[model samples]
Target chain A: MALINLAHGFVEVFQPFNMLMLFIGLVVGMAVSIMPGLGLVMGVVLALPFTYRMAIEPSVILLTAIYFSGTYAGCFSAILYRIPGEPMDVPMLWDGYTMARRGAPAKALGWALVAALIGGLVSSAVMVGLAGPMGDVALKFDSPDYFAAVFFGLTTVVALAGKSMVNSLISLCVGLLVATVGIDSIYGTERFAFGVPILRDGVQLVEVLVGMYGLGEILTRIGQGLHIEQPKETAQKVSTQFPTLRELIDIKVTLFRSTVLGTVLGVVPGAGATITAFIAYGIEKQYGRRRHLLGTGVPEGIVAPQIGATASVAGHMIPLLTLGLPGSGATAVILAAFLLHGVQPGPMLFESPASMLMVYTILASMFASVIGMCLLGFFWIRVVIKVLTIPQGILSAIVVMFCLVGSYANRNSMSDVWMIVIFGVLGYVFEKFKFPISPMVLGAILGPIGETAFMQSMISSNNDWTVFFKGPISGTLMAGSLLALSYPVLQQFLASRRRCAAVA
Target chain B: MTPGAATMPLRRLQAAAPYVVVLAVGIFLYIQADNFEFEQASGRIGPGAWPKIILVMMMATALWGVVSSALRAGHTAPEAVSEAEQDEALTQLPEIYPALVWIAVALTIAYLLLLPILGFFIATIVYTCVLMYLGHYRRPLRVALLSLAIALCFMFMFMRVVYVSLPPGVAPFDQLSYALMAAMGVH
Candidate 1:
């Protein structure tokens, strides 16, 4: 049944319009990922407005393509120049740039490309295999279980976000509070509206998203004086030279280990590509055969991070398709696109043939997107790099315009535009104060789902507080959330103890 | 007191300011949550229940931050140094220009405020040009040409291709927008 659906998905993606969208997505993803300040999440956010008019299949195909390629395209900037297009690519700077400086630029890119290809294909297979069973399991969840799961997602985001757990908690609470604004559905009473008509309708997610990630990012860059150091003129000669078979065979263990690690990490809520890449690189440093020489331009250094980052894309998609939970910032925007199309993801989606087809179509597009990304990366390396030459001022101005226009386009309300400006400032302040944005973003996106589940569970259990603990799955998940919330504090305490011992 | 010692309290207050503000807002909102009218049922939650829970959590967490900041004042522990290092790594950039950021904020708010009054095209072109100039693009003629080109392209893309109903301002600006729309073969 999955095979048939997969085959149908391939056929659907090959349709002229879907294919065009896929191509455009690849190009735009590459362009955005090669430029500094503009990243996978912001690229997806900017593209969300364009997808408003698109069919569900094409829209998703476009976004997944961007997500897939955006992970790989950042290696170009990392390998050729010292700049990391996204935080996910920062690990690439260590060995990818060193190898380039060692006069093996093409070879460094080649290893990255091959690693991305293998990681992407393997993880995509895992995603396809797991999503069905996961959906089946999700079909059995009660309201308490659902609430527990959402709670777990929120706690994981906070635990993984920033140095200070208190700050992440504060940001997340603020987001949940924002979500509570507007007329409440259960009781039909207005909330936090403050007598304003627009507030009664609630704050749109797109407005907050574009404001924080888009306009907020531009504002941060402007605060940094809008300076993007240009890559050297000699660095213009860039191309991917595929690693020899012997070279590939030599790093097979590292490749397999990183790919498996990345895929597993991707499934964990709030562990995005950046964290995966960093963890993979860290693991390789600790355990690789040439651990001592790892940072000094080793293939393991280049391959481990690129593979982990690219492979995590499929890992993220599994939960999103099966459970309607986004594991990363990029997937959060993709979730917004799904909601905008009025199609709720999860087990219910699989129950319908039409929605199932949409699911498989998106899955198949990920495979196609991976292949398309490689082809584009290999052939149009120079064209993608040329985007780095675009003046930061011009690019930032255009991004700001897009944010404003996109907000307006959401409901055709000027009020939404104003909300973006307000949130943009808030986003800047959050950055200035070292508050993590992801927990807040995920909190806003998932708050409503969590609230509905909580309300339903409470009502069904006759307001019994212990109902969540009575169920096995809900109990386990709730336990996990508690652990996640405490992990940061535990780590901080441990570190302080270690320091005190050293001082003694 | 030494200069550093004298400034320590002020620095601590600055560190706690954001949390204090969040706590204040959370308290205000919690008080407001009380007024959300709903009949208390035997076993059911009301509309304000979820918001109150969130606000309380926010206030508690913010209070924790404020207390921590105040307690940690004048104490530069090793753990604190590591935390500072982590924050520095996260920020990535070393230098920051507050004036430039404020100017951009003002420009963005101004653009949104004038968007309906001047229409998408005129307002966007002006916004882009001024932003580019402020961003250190010294060539005015080039900035003008680039801004105009960007505005026209986006106008055509959003209005014609995507069919977004962009604002058409009042009277004269509306006529200009309509004319541009017609020129681009938009109905």
Candidate 2:
């Protein structure tokens, strides 16, 4: 049934409109990922308005294509220049750039491309195979179980929060506060409107997203006073090539390991591509046969991270397609798109043939995008490299304009424009204070879901409060949430114990 | 009485800034949540119930932050050094960048305020051109052309293709949009 649906989806997605959107998404994804500072998340946010006029399947295909391509293209900037275009590209920088500096940039890029292809294909297979069973399990979940799942997603905030967990908690709370400043979802009464007419309508997520990540990033860059000029080498002739067959067989084991590792990590809520890339690279260094040559410049170094990062996109879609839970910030935006189109993704989606076909069609589109990235990547390297010289100041200005227009386009409301500015500043301050912004976004997106599930569970149980721990599935999920929340503390305790043992 | 007493309180207050703000917001939200009314009270959940729960959780986290900060401070001198290094890095940046950022901020505020009045096209053109020039795109003709091109592209994309009702400026500009959009076959 899944195969038939997927095959049917292939036919549907091959239509000119859907394929065009997918191509455009791939190009935009590559461009955005190639450009420094402007991330995959912002790229998707900017595309939201354009998708407003699109059908749900085409819109999702467009964004998902971008998400897939973005993971792969960041390596270009990371290799050619020393700058990693996105956080996920950082791991590639160490090995990819080292090889580039050694005059093997083409080879490094080739490895990145081939690895991304292999990993993406394998992960896509996993997604297609696993989504059904996961959906079946998720369909059994009650309200308490749903609440626990969201709580688990929220706990990812703590795990991803770099250096300061407290700041992450504060940022998340602020987001929750922001989410509360309108009509309650479960109850019809207004919770935090404060009697303002605009407040009653609730703050739009797109405005907040564009404002904080998009506008806020621009402001931060402008404040840093960046002045960039074109590098002379940017005009230098470059040849792009894929690895030979012999070269492909050389690092087969490394590729397999990283792809598997990335796929698994991608399934874990809160562990996104960046973490997967780093872990893949780290695993290769510790275990790969050429460990000594790892840092200096090896294909394994580049391949592991690129493959892991791209493959994780497939991993990310599993939960989103099956359970309706966003596995990363990019997936969260995609989830928002799902809601906008009046489709609540989850097991229910699988019940409908049309919805299932759309889901498979999206998956099918990703396979097309991976091939698209490879084709475009080879031809456009020189042109894409020129974007690096366009000056940070100009880029910042352009991004600001896009943010304003994008926010305004949401509902043609001036209030949304104001919301962007407010959150932009808020995001800037959060950055200055070293708070992780991802958690805040996660909190805002998941706040309604968590609240609705909690309220339902409570009301249904007549406020028993023990319902969350009564059902087997809910109890297990609750346990997982608690374990995730305390994992850092446990890690810290173990580290301290090791230190004491060393001292003794 | 002692100099340490004066400095310690100030330092502690500075360290507790995030906690103080979070706790204050939580308490404020809790108080405000008291007035939330429902037509009929549900058995276990009211309109205010969820908000109150979130507020309590926030307050608890804020308290934890304060306690954790206090507990860690005396043991971690390296954290202070790292913070100092961060401050130094910020201070090392060219002064003009901060100035430019503020200038950009002011310009954006003006743009937003003027947008509804001046309309989308005229306001966007003026805003983009001025912002580009301010950001050191010194070639006047080039800046104007680029700004015009961007504004027209966005206008066509959002207004014509998407059918978004872009804010029409007063009098002539509004008519211009209608004329322009009609010429593009949108009207």
Candidate 3:
């Protein structure tokens, strides 16, 4: 049954319309990725409203293509200019920039592209194999389990907070508060509608996304006087030079290690590409055969994090497809896209043959996107380099225009425009204070689902407070959330103790 | 690197802002959540129950933040305090001509306000041309031509292809949209 569904998806995804959309997404994504200041999450958010008029299949394929290529293209700038186009691309800069400085720019870029291809292929295979069985298991979950799952997903904010857990939690709480501004989901009661008739309709998620990530970003840059020191491109003549047979044999173990590590970490909700990239780099630096020569411009150093970050795309999709839990910020936006299209991507999503086929089609498109990205990056690296030359002030104006049109087009309501402005100002303020915005976005996306699941669990248990801990699955998930929430604090305490002991 | 100079009142105020804002928002939400009516009555979780619970968590978190910030301030040694202040200063955005931020905001507001009145086409063209000029792209012919071309392309894409019913403006400008749409066989 699964085979038949997947085969049907293969045919659907290969259709000319879906193929064209995929190609467009790759080109646009590559363009967006090569530009600094615009991160992968921003790229996804900017493309979201454009998909409003598209069918679900094309929309999913388009987004997947963007997601895939965006990861692939960031390494280009990191190698040629030492400017990481995306945060995940930062790890690539250590060895990639050094390799370029050592007059092997083509070799470093080639290694990154090759690693991305291997990682993406491996991750996709894992996703295709495991997602079906996982979805089947999720089908058996009750309301309490669902609630627990969302709660676990929410705790990702804490895991992602490197230094400021309190600020992240505050950002998350603000998102939850915003999510409650409209009519209450289950009770048909208004909670935060302060007598304004428009407020009763609730805040639109697209407006918030556009306002914060899009317009809000532009406003913040304008405030900074658009004073960014542009990185000078050193590679005058770009070429794609895949590693020779001897060189390929040299980094085989490093490649294999990062691919496996990235694939696994990608499945962990909240441990997105940036973390996976760093972890892969750390592992290579600590344990690889060429560990001493790790940061000194070697293939092993460049390949580790690039492959790990790219391969994790497949890992993120597994949980999103199975339990409808977004594992990363990119997946969070994709989840919002699925819900907007009236498709709830959980266990029930697989019960319908058509929906399952659609899901498979999207997964298949990711594979096609990897090949497309390899070809584009190999032949068009020079053209892609030109995207870096665009001035920030001009880009800001264009972005503002897109945000206005995108927000207005979402529902064609004037009120939505005002909402974007409000959220834009709020987003600008939060950013100035150095607050992480990802938690807030995740909180908004998962807020309604968490509330509904919690309410249903309460109703089913007849107001029994112990329902959450009574079930083994829910109990385990709740425990996981608590551990995740406290993990940072525990790490801090241990580090402090270690320091005291060392001093003594 | 004097301690007195480094630990200026502005730096302390900046450091405390996050905790202060979180506490204020939490208290406000708690007050608002208190007034939410319960149709299902007490004992049963109503519409307000989840929000109330979240608000309580937020308030507690805010309190923790405030206490933590205070403790952190009290524990800092004078020798290392300037070092900490320097790090914070490095992370904070430099105070450039800060009024440019407000000017950009005003420009955006003006563009939106003029959008429905002058239509997306005219409003966007004017907005972009002015923005480019201000941003140091001062070639008149280039700015005007580029803005017009970009604005039309945006209009055609959103209005004609995507079918967004953007305001056509009043009188002559409104007619331009219809004429363009009809010319393109979209109407």
Candidate 4:
């Protein structure tokens, strides 16, 4: 059944319109990601409003193509210009730039491209294998279990934020509070509405996304004087030089290790490509065969993070497709796309032929997108790099315009526009205050699911609070949440103890 | 007191302001959650329960932030901080004309306010041109052409292709919008 569905998906992707969308998505994804300050999440957010008029299949294909290519294209800037196009690309700079300075920019880019292809292809295979069985497992989830899952996602985001845990927690709580602004689902009562008729309808997730990420990012950059340093003259001569078969055989261990690590970490909610890239690079530094020569421009150094980052895209999609939970910011936008099309992407997705076809189409598109990204990166890289010359003022203006129009288009209500601006300011303030934004975004996306599950569990269990702990799954998940919440504090305590011991 | 010592209290207050505001907002919202008319049933939780719980969590975290910030004031040794904590410190951007931020914010709000009044097309072109100019694109002819082209492209894309009903303004501006839409065969 899965094979048949996947065949149909490939067929659907070959349809001219879907292929065009895929092509456009790949180009746009690469372009947006090659520019500094514009990232994968922002690219996905900007593309979302355009998908409003699209079919679910084409829209998902478009966004996933963008997501796939966005992860890989940033390496060009990271390698050549010493500027990371996305945060995930930062890991590339340690070795990619060093290698570029050593007069092998093309070779470094080639390593990245090859690494991305292998990582993306391997993880795509894993995703194809795991997503269906994962959906089947999720089919057994009850209200308490679903609540536990949502609880687990939220805790993981908070725990993994790597910033001040209190600040992350506060950001998450604010997002949860934002989710409660509309009329409650079960009780049919207005929540935090304060008598405004529009408030009763609740805040739309797209508005929050566009506001905080899209407009807020523009505002933050504007605050920094809209200054992005121009790439040096060496960036003009851009091309890719594929590593030889011998070179490929040499780094097989690093490639396998990074791909496996990336896939596993990607499955964890909140551990996105950026985190995966950094951790993979760290592991390579600690354990690579040439660990001593790392950061002095080793091919393994270039391969590890690129592979990890690209591979994790499939890992992130698994949870999104199978469980209706987004493991990262980009996936959350994709989740919004799913909800926008009225296709709930949980276990039931696999039950129906139509939704099943949609899922398979997206998976198939991931393979196509990875190949297409490499093709584009190989031939049209010089052309894509030209976008860097576009003035920051023009880019910022265009972004601001997109934010306003996108928010207004969501509901055709002026209130959403206002909400975007408000949230945009809040986002700028959050950045200024050293708070991480991902937890808040994930919190908002998952809050309603968590709340509904909790409410239903309470009703079914006659308000028995301990029912969550009674079930083995729920109990284990709740205990995980407790551990996640305590991890930072525990780490701090241990660090202080180490300090005291050193002093003694 | 030295100048650094004198400014220290003010800096701490500024740092504490956001948490204080979050605490205040959380308290206010928690109070409003009580206004939900639905009562908790024997088995079912009320609409207010979830939000109240969230608000409580928010307030507690905010309070903790405030207390920690206050407690750490004047005693935070640079050597004692963890590498990760040091890395997490907010890197202050050197503002070239710090007022540009406020000006841009005002311009954004103004543009949105004017969007329905002047229509998306007219308002967007004007807003884009002015913003670009303010952002240091000094050539008038280029800015004008680019802004007009951007607005036209967006207008066609959103209205003609995507079928979004962009703001058509009130009165005279609506007539221009209709004429443009008609010219573009967007009926």
Candidate 5:
């Protein structure tokens, strides 16, 4: 652990360019999250490919740093604009919007920043502490073990289901199916190309990722037709004070509890930060001392949700390191990034880990980016807040360009550029109707892993279906899935009955 | 927007119908393509079966999504407004078409022009300028300057260090790239 922490310090904060990237990530993350439509997932996804060219540590660090600051930046608009900048910022809306209306937008922002920064840094520390030991555990697994991890991750497709597991399942199915769209890898057979030479290479993960998240978001933003309201206050109407050390102490306990919760959830293969926030909200309502202060921009609520969300990033990496199962969208991107650079993740990754420094570089870059966020924060808010007023068309075009160049630049193929437009339309449609495009991207990312693992397990067992459940690890994971699938049903039932009783 | 409001399923249906149809068509194409396999598993496992399985999966999921939307619209609680009022009750946000449309057009144009002769670095600079304009950047000089600065920074960082081969340009700029490469310690 000492060596691990020491490695983080060894992360050469010395390079000005790498340091600049951290600052850039911090600034954009702050700005984009403040603007409507561009969520952290979008910011992270769009930014992922750019890192392919960077040294891995800096790349990962830059992306992780954005992941850190972007989530917090959403609160800025949530407080001032009565809009939740992104989905995770929704809880902040309740108290934040209230504070803004009450002429305390700045105060809400101040508290949120303090809470988010603390929450994020603490969770990152835990990640840095735990990643090495846990990653080492992954080194023991063989093909079957890899299969188990794939099995574990496949369950994550349904993680977004609010009340309908069936819809989520359908979405997951669609995503997996979409993965079959090109030349068959193993047998060299053309499956679904339909004579379009464009798709012979199969469904490109990067293209689909951008189409689904990036373009899908732009379309949704247009449909929503958002408008920014000018504030009446001439003096910026900002927060009164940053969270003082005394105030920080007051929220520290809540932060700790939330951090633990987030870390655990994040560590799980499928449960993302959204889940963490929802659960943290529930826990706060259940056990927080000032329960009445749940949504009133209370420091505890702000700190708790953030801790859970930040912890989710590092926790998500555990499965990625150990099982090669990406825990969430960013991890999915990380998986894609590794593959792009010709680094295969999973058991082989842990065995010798010839490219481990790339990942370490990402981690180093993440720490650097966080410090950069702090520095940028001093100036970013003053500038980025004005960006909110920029016309959406121009921004969308820039996004579209990135979407194209990003896809094209990956292989220097105009074919991929065209794929961007195709995916963009599909993405727009998916967004318009909320069909869960991420699942498809996730499916594409995990397709080979899932297939190879399933194939290996089958081949070893002579195509025996029963072999999928042979080991303790596999059994444990399957059992966990059954429990996860059932838990939500039971909760819904209980909640429904309580409502019935109240009505009666 | 008010929570728990139910609306006409037509909008949802209209939104989803196109995807269902496209996927359905894709399924048909996939079935036809399944027969075009390479001669006897050159590697491991015949190619046809896996792709076939994926196609069936995608079609099925899309169908499920269609059904789920229908179900959600059906089960929507009736406490707020009944089926009729829900249609008109939807709160639509304001549309800022100027920013969105121009930006999209500008991006598409830049991309089309950039792919051939101008090459990556020059193309990127031009594209970045157009983007800044689309972004409502008012000061012409600042926009141009910022665009150049951005282009230079990225060209050095991404194109040079990462060694992402910038598409070779025609004429003068092509020579410029060669010269710069020579100066930058490249063979």
Candidate 6:
């Protein structure tokens, strides 16, 4: 936390080899991000095994850098090809593609680069400043309070995400069911395997994500059909540069708001960047006409979500430091990394000098990554534009091949490929029906958290239900939810009635 | 976002089917769960109880969504374009999907066919080449070059340098991997 420690963090990564790795991480992660159906997870997964022999500090630094850079890299394609490189970058397709169509490819790419850099830099700084404090804050929470936090986190799927609260809840339930399919954590009894051994271990989150997001996407694509007219400007030249000050200022409120929102959201269990980005976008839009900036060719609009996206990742570490619970998606992956290293991350991690030093590297790596990305961003943006300019036939072919590789490379198994196909159909079906996928995904992620917390709360309370409501934290959270749920309905009804009165 | 793109009633029904199936499965689960440990008096609801609570919540939401979706159809024709729909090309289908699926299937089959015989490198190269083509790389020369690049990069980084247990393909590539390593000073 002191100046010297910050200096030490800088010295650690300033090594020649480490710096080179940063650049490689930036370039390759960006490349994967630009490829459809291959996003941050694939980028990180493929890069992970190679880093296993690496020292723990550098290995995490490399992976964490990739995690930050990969998200923005997706925006490159979303801008140029209207093909979102990843789900988190989906909103980019709205404005970036619009700008590309308007013959402002240079301006759009420039905006995207600037937005990404600012988003990354700001969020990383937030990480450096607030992680320790949040970790310090997390020290107060116990089992029931943690349970309440998880409960609120689950409800956030409805409160924060895409429309259709009911559908989100439905999806959440399905996820919990899936989460329960494996061995019971405490009793070691099998729940839902139906006698299949694979069910004994339950579905691996990696395989599930690959199938649900990757394979499911492919199936949905096939169901949509084959022949398609390509974008006319696929061959257009684009430039990447910094956005003007006015552009940065435009989303200042949004950036500030989302930074805080994401940090808070990240602390709670079960929330991830995808949720944070959407929630930030949704909330930012609600305040004014500025909402139109999103999904259109507006520079600041594109920056807002990216700001929130990166912050969510940083925000997740708070609870990991304070409560020993992983905050969100990538942090969950990091927790696994810690376990692999035989390092337990909990209250004492902050107390340990070596662990704290590593935390400094983890926080510092993002800044180093941002600089690395900025350097590579200029060059890779150009190269990727050329790649995107390839004729539709060729581009489609390459995407298809990578998509397959993405699925197959996971475990090098055929079942996963088939799983991807099945899920692709499911995704297409869901998309066709206007069913939101985030809730279902979030549900699956949160189900275990909810169930475990529920069990712990129940067991501790001896079935009194009082255990859950026993503490002020739980009571206050539950009370807050009641207000949150009803506020919107009342507000909407009043507005509608006011409109009628005006007309009368 | 388009007016005509309003979700078909049948589609809505289909969309809700997964939840209905999940609900039934949950019911079955709960029935089986009756025997699981739930010391309600002791404030220890069993795992089954926790799952049931979630499943019920899920059912309620799905029911609400299905009902609201139906009412939406009855009350309005869904002809209005909410602002979210503006500028969105609802009809334009992305070309990234079909080829991706076929390639996925092909890669799987290829992996299955060659994992025993061709080993990792051969299978990997072929997979990479096929993926490059599927990714829409038109020229065979370019596809070959890019695939070669990706394969070599991966082999060097993962297999040769890191000493990963790569699937040693048929004798030729196996020898070639060693020869390439020796030729390049890779140990």
Best by lDDT: 1
DockQ, each predicted model? 0.64, 0.46, 0.47, 0.57, 0.25, 0.32
lDDT of each: 0.87, 0.80, 0.80, 0.86, 0.64, 0.61
Poorest 10 consecutive residues of model 3 chain B by lDDT? Answer: B83-92
Better of 5 and 6 by TM-score: 5
Off by over 4 Å in 4: A234-236, A497-504, B1-3, B76-98
Sort all candidates by TM-score, best to worst. 1, 4, 3, 2, 5, 6
Q: How displaced is residue B6 in candidate 3, in Å?
A: 9.6
Evaluated at residue A86, the lDDT of candidate 6 is 61
Count backbone clashes in candidate 6. Answer: 22
Write down the TM-score for model 6: 0.77
Best by DockQ: 1
Comparing 1 and 3 by TM-score, which wins? 1
**Candidate 5: lDDT of A420?**
71
Which lDDT tens digits does candidate 2 get at residues B81-140? Answer: 543233224212333466776677788899988877778788888998878776666688
lDDT of 1: 0.87
Displacement of the residue B132 alpha carbon in candidate 6, Å: 6.9
lDDT of the structure predicted as candidate 3:
0.80
| Model 3 bad stretches (over 4 Å) | A1-4, A227-236, A497-504, B1-10, B73-97, B133-138
Predicted complex 1: CAPRI docking category: medium
Question: Native-vs-model 4 lDDT?
Answer: 0.86
lDDT digits (tens) for residues A1-504 of candidate 5:
435644744465446766777776777777777776777778877887687776655565566667767766766666667555666766666566676677766667677666666656666667767666667767765566666666566665565544455445555655665676676555556666767898777777788788778866665555454344543343353433576788777766687788788877887766777668767766887898877877666666666766676667767765675566786777887777666766665545444544454445555555555556655554456566676766664566467556666776688778877777667766765544455565666777777777667667766666666765677767776766667767766777898899799899
Candidate 2 docks at the CAPRI level of: acceptable
DockQ of 6: 0.32
Instruction: Identify the runs in model 2 with alpha carbons over 4 angstroms from their true place.
Output: A227-232, A494-504, B1-12, B39-42, B70-96, B172-176
For residues A265-380, what per-residue lDDT tens digits would candidate 4 score against the true structure?
88989888988998899899999999999888999989999999999999999889988999788999999998998888899998888888888999988889999999999999
True contacts kept of each: 0.74, 0.58, 0.50, 0.64, 0.35, 0.40
Task: Show the lowest summed lDDT stretch of 10 residues, model 5 chain A.
Answer: A231-240
Poorest 10 consecutive residues of model 1 chain A by lDDT? A228-237
Q: Model 3's CAPRI class?
A: acceptable
Worst 10 residues of 6 chain A by lDDT: A392-401
Quantify how close model 1 is to the true structure by its C-alpha RMSD in Å.
2.0
